[model samples]
Target: MASATRAGHRWLKWVGFLCVLCAIAFAVVWYARNANGNEPALNTVAVSRGDIQNLVSATGVLEPSNYVDVGAQVSGQLELIHVRVGQPVSTGDLLAEIDPTVYVAKVDATRAQLKNQQAQLADRKAQLRLAEIQFQRQQNLWREDATTRESLQTSEASLASARAQLAMLEAQIEQTSSTLRAEEANLGYARIYAPMDGTVVSIEARQGQTLNASQTAPLLMRIANLSTMRVRAQVSEADVGKLQAGMRVYFTTLGDAEHKLYGELQYIEPTPEVTNNVVLYNALFTVDNQEGRLLPQMTAQVFFIQEEALDVLRVPVSAVARNQVKVLDAKGQPQIRAIETGISNRVYVEVRSGLNEGDQVVLANRDPRAGQGESRAAFRGMLR
Candidate 1:
């Protein structure tokens, strides 16, 4: 009975050992399958014709190409606003009106003062004429010995004084006339008119609001020509040197992949803006926005084209190692080929002088013996 029990116990131990081995084999097989699936099999690829472009990317903002701020030239109470935000206006169209009561009163007072000065000037002229006549008569009487020399001298002094008084009155009248003209201009300024044909984009002053334009012209509203848009792109200093005026550039709005707005680089600002220890420069360009789809302050993704090749033979960058590519010859044998490359954007490279199209380029060695060895090594690593 003890010998039979020992045999059964040994049999049960073998079964348990076999189960453990099966579990380990299952896990190893699963791990090997997953490892193969996770990695890319860049074994070989055919040289194909495609488009390649080297571009410099930057972020930008959209704004109206032509915009103006309409401000109050004369300070007064804003009595009426004829235009609202987003309203279309023409040149010379009434935009807003300030209280014209004070300006009108000033103009009337200046006119009255100017008229009074003018009357005084006329009276002075009459008095001068009379004095001249008296002086002439006195000179004749003195020459004839009919009047005293003292009387002739007094007449001459009166004539001189009258001329001086007339001259002073004329100057005062000229000054008053100038004041009248200024007051008239101020009164006209109370009625604000659009300087250009555009749409009113903003309003800073509301009706019945008091505006003080003593130091600076108070902004009443803003007008913009939305038919055209300007783009201001901020490019890093490192990339700014690569750009130039008249370079072909394009941009798109966020999530707008269908439309591409193209324009030539117009200018690059000389001053650099430093932010977060990084220097950036602004690049400006304009595009037609007649449809009014582009708005002010919209963010854009800008791309400046540096180089481009269309319908050219290209290959993945990984396929070429050490400036040499492994190509499969007619005999199905791997051979090293020298290749001349062109513009590249890090993903694909333009093939300038390379093997013919449809030529198979080897990315990785796929020899059966080598593959078996690699698989064995990967399996052992997983087990460890």
Candidate 2:
């Protein structure tokens, strides 16, 4: 009985060992299948003909191409403002007026002084003529032996003195005339006129306000020619070197993003502005505003087109790495190909050479099947 029991126990142990081996085999097969399924493959995109533009973006403010701050040159009470803000004015049009009372009185006084000097000059000339006649008569009398030598000498001395007085009066008249002209100019300043054709954009002085222009000219108003607008774009110092005068640029205002206004780069300021340790330079461009749509101080999103390519072979920028691209050749094998690129817009890069429109380029390495396997493995882990 003992021998039979021992044999039966040994058979039961063998059966348990076989069951363990089966379980181990099943686990190995499951793991191998999942591991094989999780292997990744290369992802790719096709090269195609498309347009790409390389641009530098910046924010800027719009301003008038031509603007001026009209000021009062002479001090007086601001009597009238001929043009209101937003009013269109032509050159020489009256813009404002100061009280002409003081200027007119000054002009009158200067004119009177000038006239007095002229009358004095005429009197001096009359006296000079009389003296010359007396001197000549005295000389003739002396030659005829009718006058004494002393009398002739006295007459000559008197003539010389009269001539000197006349010369002095003439100089005085010239000085007075210059003063009169200056007073007249000041009188004209009381009536301020527009220096150019534009619209009044600002008014700094009000009627009845007293202006003291003894030191600095008092600002009265500002005029802006809205026919053309300029955008002052601040670009980073790093990008400023790429900008050049006459390069094509376009901008859109916050209010009118649908419409784009184009212009050429007019200038790039040599000096840079530093803000928070970052340097920026101002780039200027002008655009026509005939429709009066563009206004001063309007914020704009500016684009400087550095380069562009149209209907050229292009591919995903991600496909190009370090001036080379991983391309799938005719044999469907990945190979590195050196390529020349022209313009890139962050997403698409223009292929200048060494690539064809129908060729495929590897953008990234991705495996959709591996993702599924990972999901299944995660599920199995959660079940465990």
Candidate 3:
């Protein structure tokens, strides 16, 4: 019985030893699997350096390069309107006409007065000729003792009076002629004509409208050249300093936000406009309108191309690590790097320094899927 009990104890000890060995083998395999955790699931981008440019944006209005205010020089009832609004006209094209009857009557009356003065002058000259002949005959009679001293004096007085009368009439003729010419000029002013070669943008006077030119010329209409347009952009004081002539610009009108037009900066006003205590500078640009699509006073959104870059390495601004970037070192281990940045359009920042061509820059990591058992195992190993 003692021998049998000793054999059972030895068998129990062997079984316990086998169980411990199995546990040790399982732990070795588990550790080996855990040690090879899945690589970090990260998004990366290649870094490269290249040129970049900056820009500033603003808003403005479109206007004509040249505009004119067509006005009435004479006050009268508008008898007729020869042109309609937006009609193209050339210089000397009759735009409108005031009733010329009154002016014409005045001219006729002044001309009649001038003719009357001329007739009186002619009559006076005839009388002078008769008086001169009598004076010469009287002088001959006095020399021959056939006339008295009183007769000779009377003839001389008549001659002098006739000469004085002729002088007065001639002076009257000159004065009346001047008045007639002035009246004729006033009559001519009744016809209104275009002063420039452009389109009639507006018509302030309609048929039968009375114009008052006693004080102001009474703006009858406005004319503008639409072939070329100007964009007068009021830039903020902050961005105005960077604006210069010859810069590239583009703008879109307020109409449906539909079309975009390109132009070059032509001028920048040296003085700033102050309204309600706010200061703004005026920047002007020119755009061709061969299509005639642009109109006056159209609000425009403007962009000034201050700088630009083409075909360069770029990355999302969010991918750039704050204060550092971790990159693989020469030994293939992660190393922290300092970098300098350049122009950013708020979406991407130009990496100007501390990176190389085709270098991988780490971005954000996404969450693993629910069924990613291998990934979970890797994650657990990393935590351990």
Highest TM-score, which number?
1
Ranking by lDDT: 2, 1, 3
lDDT of 1 by residue, 1-384 (tens): 999999999999999888768867886786687568544343789999998988999999998899899999899899999988899899999999999999999998998888888888889989999999999999999889999999999999999999999989888888888888899999999999999989899998889999998999999999999998999999999999889998999999986857898999999999988999999999999999888889899999999988788899998888888678989888766799999988877888888896789999987555443465677677668545
* Overall lDDT per candidate, in order of appearance: 0.89, 0.90, 0.82
- Tell me the spans in candidate 1 whose CA falls farther than 4 Å from its real position: 1-46, 322-337, 355-371, 374-384
Error of 1 at 244 (Å): 3.7
TM-score of each: 0.80, 0.79, 0.68
Q: Enumerate residue pairs that collide in model 1.
A: none
Please provide, for model 2 over 137-156, each residue's C-alpha lDDT reduced to its tens digit, 9 standing for 90 to 100: 99899989999999999999
Q: In lDDT terms, how accurate is model 2? A: 0.90
Write down the TM-score for model 1: 0.80
Off by over 4 Å in 3: 1-53, 128-164, 255-260, 275-277, 309-384
Separately for all candidates shown, the number of backbone clashes (residues 3 or more apart, or on different chains) is 0, 0, 2
Off by over 4 Å in 2: 1-50, 318-342, 351-365, 371-384
lDDT of 3 by residue, 259-294 (tens): 768789989998998989878899998899777888
